[model samples]
Target chain A: MLTSCTNAIILTVNGDEHMLVVEPNELLINVLRNELGLTGSKYGCGTGQCGACTVLIDGEPALACVTLAVACDGKEIVTIEGIARPDGGLHPIQEEFLGENAVQCGFCTPGMILMAGDLLKRNPHPTEPEIRHHIKGNICRCTGYNGIVRAIQHAAARMAEPAAADGPDLVKEAR
Target chain B: MKLESYVRPAGLEEALAVLAAPGPKALVFAGGTDLVPMMRKMRMNGTLLNGDSPRVILDLSKLDELCGIRKAGGMLEIGAATTMGVIAADPSVKKLVPVLAAAAASVGSPLVRNRATLGGNLVTASPSADTAPALLAAGAVVRLAGAEGGPRELPLSEFFVAYRKTALQPGEIVTHVLVPLAGRPVAGRFEKVGLRNADAISVVCAACEIELEGSTCRAARIGLGAVAAVPVRALAVEAALLGREITADVAAECARLVHEHISPIDDVRASAQYRGWVAEAVVARMITDTAREAGA
Candidate 1:
């Protein structure tokens, strides 16, 4: 969908700098999946309505499907593949999602986990309603959202531990 | 759409210059939440991507000149490029004009708010634009910077021309929005009804601001969205409320008058009759809520 030559962009994905050539119409989700082979972010609606392609841009949740790759020239982005320890230990949010049976088909997990991770980082002791409010964008067609909300609450409790005080940092590894 | 080039202008002047060029079908975008999807749909329809001429995108995300919220000279000045998330969460907005914050908070969701901009919301000019009614009720003024002349200011009410239209001219960009802080005590309320709790376009939304003096209405402003061609102010209702005591009977009259003022049409989200009824009910609730909050 581009007529001109590819433009150079230096994107810090999962704490690693990758200089790639992208087109003007290329979306962030496409760049993350095709160019970088990080397919953790799913492309559900291609529109912003669905949170299937949600990712973190500067520690805030953004819909990658609507986000242009050209606009994200020098920003730090985090995908679901990056939300784990270097030693292969699962992030607390990821572990809790499993324990709460939040994964039905597992399509919306990446966005849900990242959104919950960002929420816990901002509010270490968010109430149940607050947990539901944070993941409003990420939709789960299978679990009916009860399990997802429960998983976020469980993650908040786990991340509140003194050793895991830095909730988002636990998932943010230096690759 | 097949984009031939992308330009990231460093400043407002450079951006205006890029838009003035006549080679390709150039378009300026801030968040791209709305424009990107429209273009993608155009491409899917086989209309834009395979066209003969090229399409150019002027990315305005890096233009820091149009992104922030500040208070100066007794007004809240919001940069046009400021994201909805930032505006909704800003302490000053939350404290002074909570209705605007509520409207912004009710927008799509966190991800959508993170990327959606105030300028984009206005520029798109959807009849159901979430922030339009709130800004209109607050009496906002928009600042536009163009290529030829110095910046100009226009009241937010006059900025919208028609359905999906605005008063913006070619090569002009929305720079800032000025919202006057009321010197007197005021209470505001905002309400929206959607199909679902989140991520649903508004079926009907209403916002009201009132200034009270000993249980009598000193002044009032009312705005409604999705009931007309453009988000509109309820002049008849505002006129009826002024100088009248805030009461259930007065609110009923104002709510009835709302139906007389708006021209709604049946659409996918709602029926014209449903919008008319909801407009009345929502306005009545907002008026009563704001009156109670103002102790009137």
Candidate 2:
């Protein structure tokens, strides 16, 4: 049996730093939802099978459920709640996801948006297959996945427009 | 089910100190992709039975000693803690061992690949580990480091002993996987038959590597998974292909030999009979495809 240990850690979540005490066994999803009240990242499978708990750890897509809170110390975590602009504006990907009618039950939207954001940031212009491949982990039982794929593609096009007129400066401001 | 302590050792020695501390049982977690879920299930089962689960998790993700993908001394050395995603995208690794890269790519999904480490996959010793078949086909050597022995090397074929078990001794951990690239020009291919195209555990997976000389096979290796207690090299299949021109007839014989060699049991993923059939099919397809790629 492992000896029980709790640790105090500083977590940088969504540009805000929070000092919290966590048990070694506490998962990042629970810490994000219960401790900090950032419930935008949902717990779907709790086994990391579903990507509803996906968050950006240093701009990379990561499942928060399987990830231990203690392991994520000192990393920058960006949840769905953190993607909104300071002026109370929805991020471009969020705007596009809504515009493309990608929300079915909205349970998987946060993860889908984050995952698409990750893909778009890495590849400004991705083919349909690439977008589909990126979000394969994030399951959307509703909308038949066609709309989700279309939403990610649309988000990619909007994000790569090189104009801040219609869309927020997502590439610069978000990351 | 309570976790006792989470230690992120700065170096291998510090990590060994925690592992050899002589108190609570400690387990090494590289990415925690497989370990975390297994731990959760164990904790739940333990709570029901009033038993003890792993208490200490020695997080190895932060250790620089166990995290990299590079070529050194004419070998492609992948650190044990290197994530599957990085391995899949690494240019050098992809160029040297395309089959390993493909196997790494076929694992789970993007999110899982980002967190699943090569060492975690091997140490878990899952018969269906996607990377194992390819690494086994490539003739990779695993490097182990311990508090006592310092470091040692073992062929990947000898690393796995049984289901979910490895040859790792107490306080010893995998440090790097070395893929030797000194011999003949080799071409490889990896194939997986699963319930879905992506994010599904393998019903059967195969990795085939071939060395060719003007439409004749000089050497061949076949690794098959999910058909036995451990990932196995298909020696019978390799024998059928070596020193012979890879052809449709040879491929058919190799398939039959694959079925003869594997001893599969009926599991939730597939029936024993079905696994046997698919195992041969995957190995056959991979061999033919890899041979064709090499112009055999």
| Local accuracy of candidate 2 as per-residue lDDT tens digits, B104-220 | 999999999999999989988899999999998999999999888669999999998977778998778899999998872479998998988768999988898999888888888
True contacts kept of 2: 0.63
**Regions more than 4 Å wrong, model 1:** A1-5, A164-175, B45-54
lDDT of 2: 0.85
Q: Tell me the TM-score for chain B of model 2.
A: 0.95
Question: Taking the tens digit of each residue's C-alpha lDDT, what string does model 1 give over B59-156?
Answer: 77668888999988888999888999999999999998887898999999888998899998998899899999999988889999888879999999
Kindly report which residue stretches of model 2 are placed more than 4 angstroms away from their true locations once superposed: A1-5, A164-175, B45-52
Evaluated with DockQ, which candidate comes out highest?
2
Candidate that scores best on TM-score: 2
lDDT of 1 by residue, A1-175 (tens): 2123467888999999999888788899999999999999999988888799999998788999999887788899999988887777788888877777788898898998998988988999999888888888888888559988887887888778977744455543322
Against the reference, the lDDT scores of all candidates come to: 0.85, 0.85
Query: Given candidate 1, what's the lDDT at residue A93?
Result: 82
